[model samples]
Target: MRSEFCNALVGRSGNENVLFMTGDLGYMALEPLQEALGERFINAGVAEQNMISVAAALSRQGFEVWAYSIAPFCYARPFEQIRNDIAFNDLPVKLVGNGGGYAYGVMGPSHHAIEDYGVLLTLPNMRVYAPVFNEDISAVVNCLSSELRPSYLRLGRGEAPDGYVIPQYAAWRQLTYGDGIVIIAVGPLASTYIGAFEKLPKTQRPNLWAVAQMPISANPLPSELLSQISSAPALCVAEEHVKRGGFASELALYLAEGGKMPKQFRHHYALAHTYGTYGSQQFLRSLSALDEGTLLSTIAEFAPTSV
Candidate 1:
């Protein structure tokens, strides 16, 4: 996906105006970006904070700057830089963060970015996108090219799960619909939700919506779409990150403001409030009940009337 992003940016009509900056990482896969877009690419040598500030400054000078780093370094380490530089200035800087959540697995808690969404979502003028598959990544890139505000794209380390094939340049798409309950699943967890849906009889499947890109602007949610969801008997939000300030929390706040409260709700997310030792991604997922079995059980237990 990173390679695809680089190639797509290089082939754009105004490739000369594109700038790519990284914290001296991506040494193996990002050589071409530096070789081809030499004048437009910078290796900021491990300074994540400075890199963001520089990217914002360059964006102000009319360059479409993209900053890349592992998730922890990209967002957590330089959160203030992101807030005051990119977000405050409303620069057109695209933050391409690799290995979101437990994607880094054995890289340890220091590298895991289970709290990035919670942090990034608080910054004003910043949009967040977590593409579930290859197609979704392409769509997000296309959207970011024309977008005038700061944007962040959280990507996994390996091949994404195959479930929804979002169309190129499409910002959002709905995967399923029902009246009894509304299940909002984001990122790769959407694929897990599809599997959970299969476990239920067709008649038991609740209304479901898969939003790959959850923008920072709270009011952009289509009122018609939200009304349908808010009208359901119950609502559940599932995501790969923590519960606070993540998709579930944000959706809950949205519904609360609309004066529609579902009788039952659940925010199935990580509980890693503290750091831990290095381990495999699968192991970490199970520890946090993000695996298939756990997710299915949670959905079954919270399935509206089942409550």
Candidate 2:
């Protein structure tokens, strides 16, 4: 996603109105953007709140300002600042949260950002984006660039499977066709099942899809997307965030309010507790309920032996 962001900045080289700020967290991913955008790229130095405040001020002066940092600090440190300076004032400052979910494994719970989507989505007029496929990064960045609104971009480290790819940035991507049960995976978790799910026979497979863009912005899952797999016996959601206010919760409200609730519903997410242990992302996921094994096992309980 940072690669796409850098490319987009370079794509607008002469646009002096564009400005980038960081809270001392953009290591190698943002250096290219920094070099390409010289004075326009400023390091605010370990101050996420001040960084957001300054970006809000800059945007008020007709500059397109973007503040970038780790997911936890970007939101946690500057919660009030963002709510007031940016979203409250209706500024166009774009806040990008890198290393979303457990991306900063070994950095401990303080670094892992498991609650970003829920918090940001609840903010009035704050647009939240989570891109499942690396290829969709540029599209999300460019889409926000054209609009003048408060936006939060949640990004992963871009780890995808070897071959399967997607083009075009739809709010969601359908991964399979099934009539029994539908499994909805959010963020990078979509890639986890892409490999293992293929190993299942044609008849055993369930309809799989990736929902990245926040429903607050996308409004609702596309009518066609819902029509496709929603008829399944049950609707299961797998997310890297907590189960309460995250994607699954919002989806349930959407379904209930819209009278589109599926036959049955189930959700799996990160545990609602601090992840004390630090290790590889895979190891961390295992500790949480979002591990591939746990996710599949959870779904298996509701499906037949074919799954």
On TM-score, the leading prediction is 2
lDDT of 1 at 241: 89
Clash tally for model 2? 1
List TM-scores for all candidates, in order.
Answer: 0.87, 0.93
**Stretches of model 2 off by over 4 angstroms after superposition:** 305-307
Error of 1 at 306 (Å): 11
Model 2 C-alpha lDDT versus the unseen true structure: 0.78
lDDT of 1 by residue, 1-307 (tens): 6676666666663568888889888867777767788767789988998999999899999988889998889998888889998898888899988877788788778878787877887788777878765555655678888878888888873243355444343344455554446677667556555655654665457666666676525325555557766566567776778877788787777668877677778776877835455478777877877776776676566555644
Using lDDT as the measure, the top candidate is: 2
Q: Candidate 2, 216: how far from true, in Å?
A: 3.8
